[model samples]
Target: MRSFFMPFAIYVLGLAVFAQGTSEFMLSGLVPDVADDLHISIPAAGWLTSAYAVGMVLGAPLVAMLSIRWPRRRALLIFLLTFLLAHVLGAMTSSFEVLLGTRIVAALANAGFLAVGLAAASAMVGSQAKGRATSVLLSGVTLACIAGVPLGAVLSEFWGWRSAFWAVAIVSVPAVIAILCAVPASAVDPNAPTARHELRALRTPRLAVTLLLGALVNGATFCTFTYLAPLVTDVAALSTNWVPVALALFGIGSFVGVTIGGRFADTKPLQLLTIGAIALLGGWLLFALTAANPITALALVFVQGTLSFAVGSTLIAQALYAATDAPTLAGGFATAAFNVGAAVGPVLGGIAIDAGLGYRSPLLVSAALVALALVSYSVARNAAHRSNHSRGRSPESF
Candidate 1:
């Protein structure tokens, strides 16, 4: 019974993540519709994406600290409900200001749910399976990219952008019910680390570097991903009808990447990160150069997406592992780190475009960020080696 129920509970959590991740990413496809509907400039509309990310960055640690002592099921349910409410409000609001407010509220709810959900999923599995568990949760996000994001674009194209919000709200209902029925109260640790201990975990150099790596990798991803619609149609010279296809292909690659990362990350984290980052940088560079060719651009989009998520998911598992001493807040730290990248990436991409760098600028921006990520990894590897040497440990022990 425990075995049967555990996977069901984890997938339910993933379902909730699917709903939130849909909301988080669907905006990339709806940017023009949102701008036209709200009578805002395109860049201004793009800021909505940044706003959600910013809220996540602030909300993750805040919600984690506040719910440190609460029952895991209770925290998850409350956040899930708040997310539903925010979407409903967003769907009902025509005023951009109100919509922005809704996005922030929704993001707070998303951040809380993700932090709690990751902790809960990891706790349910054995130590050896933590990477697999993390992948299961993140798979929802990849699946969202595959189906929800493209469907949101289709819905927006046909029924209007608000329908996308309504769809997310509707999808979240089943997840709420599942959580209530399937999640056990014991998911929460009664003697969870104090908030101080959780914060102290951040001071570890290795953990800090891991978090930075997550930020850089995710930043590179969103920098390109957030502007994919424009890149497909404007730069690649594809029809608007190709936007969803491009997005779906990227999603497909992400799903594949996450699966591969999850399979090997437990035993070969450093190698996965190292190779994935290099390949991702090369993919981004190739994308920038060939973005004018529709076919090549589309193909590279898929390749870059795979490499991006492969590295991104591994970084997430690494962050959680490095912060093992602060089990309760481990997810929060990872959440905050990735969203920091999410927030900054698009903003920088937008700035580049605004400065007349062209639609391909985001691809170049992504490449640069990945390059920096590679350098950071080298620094981290050397530092790990020096520390391990002093302790008479193998470098691979890192």
Candidate 2:
């Protein structure tokens, strides 16, 4: 086995993957800027976010299952190249429709990139370091919240949303180069045994429940967060400049949440997920009630972002536990489901606002989704315990 500095590999891979992420999420804060520049409605601008996630949902597992036999490094390189080219296309395009179309293309690569990246990152270090490496990769996502998103928003304010795409284009190329240079080539065989094994893993009751929990939890979080900028600026009376800072603060919160949540995920991942969803419900409710005050509203927003994304590493950890026989496929599939949640959040929130439900209604709806997920988890847990008890006894003994 070749020796690799887990931290450096993580930093490089995470940054490369982070560029892909920021390309998707930075659009959330820049919606108004994008709308104004393209002469489109804000609802239309939101499709850019939805389109990217839709691509991820369609791409992640489809690629993962199909490429099961390919070398990991080669697959990643192909994905990264496409991811970079999509941004280049976005930067040069003038039509909002073309931009939206390009975003979906980018997501195809982005989802495959992340699914492969998670597998590669896990292989970087020793066994004990797997959770930490996953956390570090996900931390890239948290970093985008602090550094990438705010910077994108500021650039959009000055140079228009095109500048944001240009920034994404610039960073993506170098990251792609570094990834290609640094990552060692490795393959996971997709022969009948592995295929049959993963198919069996997918059929497991625990794995199904875990993916369900992920969709519900993620849908709950995004249902409010995708519209967070609009809620802060239009409904809460904050200046546009403040959107950057608020986003940065929210990123900081996510940093704390993920670090703390990462540790808990290893020990009792599913239990932690239920707890995280409860926190999400509380955060959304608080946001809905207090969004009228700028300072208080931003505080809740930061807390919401922090708590929700912090739960991510935990959720992935849960999926791995549930599908231990097929970590890569589970990771890819669960993440695609999470991407589906992202697609739903902005589109639903944007529609609610457009329909005159008011900005706060989205947060309220998020609260309800969280509440529903919480109940579902409780029932699942109870049923699991009962099943265990039933299995412990002999059927003929009675």
Name the TM-score of candidate 1.
0.91
Evaluated at residue 360, the lDDT of candidate 2 is: 88
What is the lDDT for 121 in model 2? 72
Instruction: Candidate 1: list runs displaced more than 4 Å.
Output: 1-6, 29-47, 94-96, 187-190
**Candidate models: Cα lDDT each:** 0.88, 0.75
Q: Residue 243: error of model 1 in Å?
A: 2.5
The C-alpha TM-scores of every prediction are 0.91, 0.85
| Candidate 2 lDDT tens digits, 104-216 | 88888887778777767766664445556667778888888778887898798888888898898788777777777788756555462364567677787767766776776
> Candidate 2 overall Cα lDDT vs. reference?
0.75
Worst 10 residues of 1 by lDDT: 1-10
Candidate 1, residues 25-101, lDDT tens digits: the string is: 89977989999988999998887887898899999989888887888899999999999999999999889999999
Superposed by TM-score, candidate 1 places the C-alpha of residue 310 at a distance from the truth, in angstroms, of: 0.4
Q: What is the lDDT of residue 12 in candidate 1?
A: 95
